[model samples]
Target: MTPIRHNGSGSGSDNDHVLDAVRDCVLAVGVRRTTLADVARRAGVSRMTLYRRWPDLRSLVGDLMTREWIDVATRAMAEPAPGTATRTRIVDGLVAGVGAFRAHPLFRKIVDVDPELLLPYVLDRRGASQEALLALLADALREGHADGSVRPGHTERQARVLLLTVQSFALSLRTMTDEDDPELDSAALLGELRTLLERTLTP
Candidate 1:
């Protein structure tokens, strides 16, 4: 296939399309195998255009992963169903967020083949993505506390700890054997988390 041509325009809609195209390619081919050429072909843009937006495959994949995580966090924190308990909502949202990480094949494969791929972003605990997620979780928790839904004292510290705890659960899921029932464990763990948070924040 001929390489795609570059359009050189950095419009918001254009960037969204590029990101969307990259997402599809990563999902289809996995991150390691998905080349700039592949993304261009799927996006219908020139390889030059993709390169213009993201100079290398690593940068493109990184951005794609970041965008995906942000989306997951947003969806997980969205309003829970009517009549749902606030504690349940928080636990379910966290469970869903962790599930997304465990299920994303591209991320799973990368971490499996080269565990260090996640080191700087997750294990390192100080990466930009981690910081962003921490802030997001803190904001979510603070809002809940303000509304009398979440537990109260030391919102910042507690939110950071909660996010780290969630990360630990996600990492453990990746190592679990096939015989281990992830669904059951996820439910039990989430229940425990909710109970802990309730006790910590209860008025």
Candidate 2:
């Protein structure tokens, strides 16, 4: 069990392999059954190699999900369509974010395979990924404010609220008990999200 003091070196590909192994293992045998030994075996690395970075299963999975979603969120926020208004850009960013969560393999596997492993992250304070999302949204909100498309309010606060709201519904859309007359399908919900963002941020 040799511990590598520096984690930022060749650890890059090794870490990716470990997380990829984690993703595959979760998708196959589920989170409860997955283990460092299993991930190491699947990753073709030693258990100590993983221990050098993540001490346990939960932290490994956290890193895996954070990696998966951060890439998706980056894509959704970075590339705004031509001629999109600032408000509309935020709307599309949020909506794209929801779509990213729904479509992500790790996300679906967690909900379908072992949801209990996900509850802690949802019920508690924001994790690294969630906080990162809030920051990204906050930056977008600030941009919108500069363009006079966003309403006068605390940018960071509004971004946090929006991130929490979107993550709450996005993560649990399948099981959330809404009292609205007729349930809104995913498409309709995105449409409503668009409308809500438009109204909330517009002058």
Candidate 3:
């Protein structure tokens, strides 16, 4: 996902207001039904204002997703117990991130109503958000290696593999879950994910 260039003049708060409108519109009618006019109206800005910032609805939505997902990952990574080992922090952050994404309203909305929008990122190529996440994971892995907590390897490759594993669980966990069976429920599966990640990163 290329970063959405804001060629227009606006404060950060102004941009946030527009994004808030977009989010509300998406939550109400999804991506297909949303229009520039709708966003402009809801945001109390002209369509030209939005046009200057984003070329199309897809680009706007892409930026929105990037903002949302990064925030989720950042929050998760920041909240681990103090003085935790690098490996433990990495594993706990990822598990918490998976859970956060699974429970996020916007994420649930996109998955339920605009899942096809995600297919390109999943199947064809990496997006900006995915690249950002990979960078974060790679950095953490490097720190883990320095601390003798993670196995020695190519940090980038290890990060990519960790991402692939967590991505699968985040996107597909619901499909495999059995609400009636506690052993197969989401929490149970997430625990398994935590264990898998810890083992993978541990020396």
Pick by TM-score: which candidate is best? 3
| Model 3, global lDDT | 0.87
Candidate 1 residue lDDT tens string, 1-203: 00122234588687778778877776665667778888888778999877777778777766666666667767776585666655556666777777777777656666666465566655443544566677877776776776677777687787778777777777775354343676556566655655665575455
- In terms of TM-score, which candidate is stronger, 2 or 3? 3
- Scanning candidate 1 in windows of ten residues, the lowest lDDT window is 1-10
Q: State model 1's lDDT.
A: 0.67
Candidate with top lDDT is: 3
Q: How well does candidate 3 score on lDDT at residue 89?
A: 84
RMSD of each: 5.8, 4.6, 2.0
Greater-lDDT candidate between 1 and 3: 3
Lowest summed-lDDT stretch of 10 residues in model 2? 1-10
Ranked by TM-score from best down, the candidates are 3, 2, 1
For model 2 the TM-score comes to 0.86
Candidate 3: which stretches are off by over 4 Å? 1-10, 79-82
In model 2, the runs with Cα more than 4 Å from the true position are: 1-10, 78-82, 176-183
lDDT score, residue 73, model 2? 83
Against the unseen true structure, what C-alpha lDDT does each candidate score?
A: 0.67, 0.76, 0.87
